[model samples]
Target: MNLLKKDLADGISFSGEKDGHCITCLEGKQSRNYSEELEGKCLQLVHSDVCGPMSQESRSGGRYFLTFIDDHTRKVFVYIIRSKVEVFEKFREFKSQFENQTGKQIKILRTDKGSGYVNRDFKNFLRNQGIKHELTIPYSPEKN
Candidate 1:
């Protein structure tokens, strides 16, 4: 430290202080919390998410996929589509089939606030069905 100060140093300070908000260390930390608990019965709280627009397509030319999971049963239903526009249609199909088989109407729909779930058509459909729609905060996938 003395040699560095005397020989080649310009304006460097050698303090023993620590940075509490060190970006390098913070960036390396992963979140370590368990997800929120799932409550209620089958068809009472349904969670849905849409994924992809991948570069590679399936044999049927599908590039997007949608998933519906029952909170109580953890039963999942999935559908593959060619585009986002088919989201409402897939929801309708899932709702009808699941409700018919389970004999219980879906009470709440939980999803991230993506355009597929927040659009006018989807909103109207949920409203007409009397199903409450719950959206997690934007950019927080862990909340979903």
Candidate 2:
């Protein structure tokens, strides 16, 4: 503003508004919130969650649904399941099939700290495949 005044800005001037905040300057310093996707490469990160025990079951007798989302691409894969036990299997299948199809390995997985994902079998599978698992705090659905 001082430079503009000294160098002759024709119609724009801050000469009288010298004591308060400058909206333009403040806005210029702000930035968009950073997303959880690291480096933004496809298959780099995934988010998984299960929503189930629904009141109305699907025609196939599915009582639950599992979801797998690619953080970078925002691609979503949903699986209707008969039970929560299917979560681990569905996740494994999703990982294998997606990796094979894309020719890229998933480096990380993010999920809520639910039993379906935190069980011994699920932990073993993730460890064996070298996939990092990030768990949202329990009860904090917003973070998930």
Report the C-alpha lDDT of model 2 over 1-144, residue by residue, as the tens digit: 544446555576443433454455556668654343333588888888888689999999999889888877777999999988888989889988988877789999998998888999999888998999899987665665
Model 1, residue 31: what's the lDDT? 53
Tell me the tens digit of each residue's lDDT in model 1 across 2-76: 334355544645433235333443555655332222233667888888888888999999999999998877778
Total backbone collisions, model 1: 0
Per-residue lDDT value at 58 in model 1: 90
lDDT, each prediction: 0.80, 0.80
Candidate number of the best TM-score: 2
* Cα error, candidate 2, residue 131 (Å): 0.4
RMSD of each: 10.7, 8.8
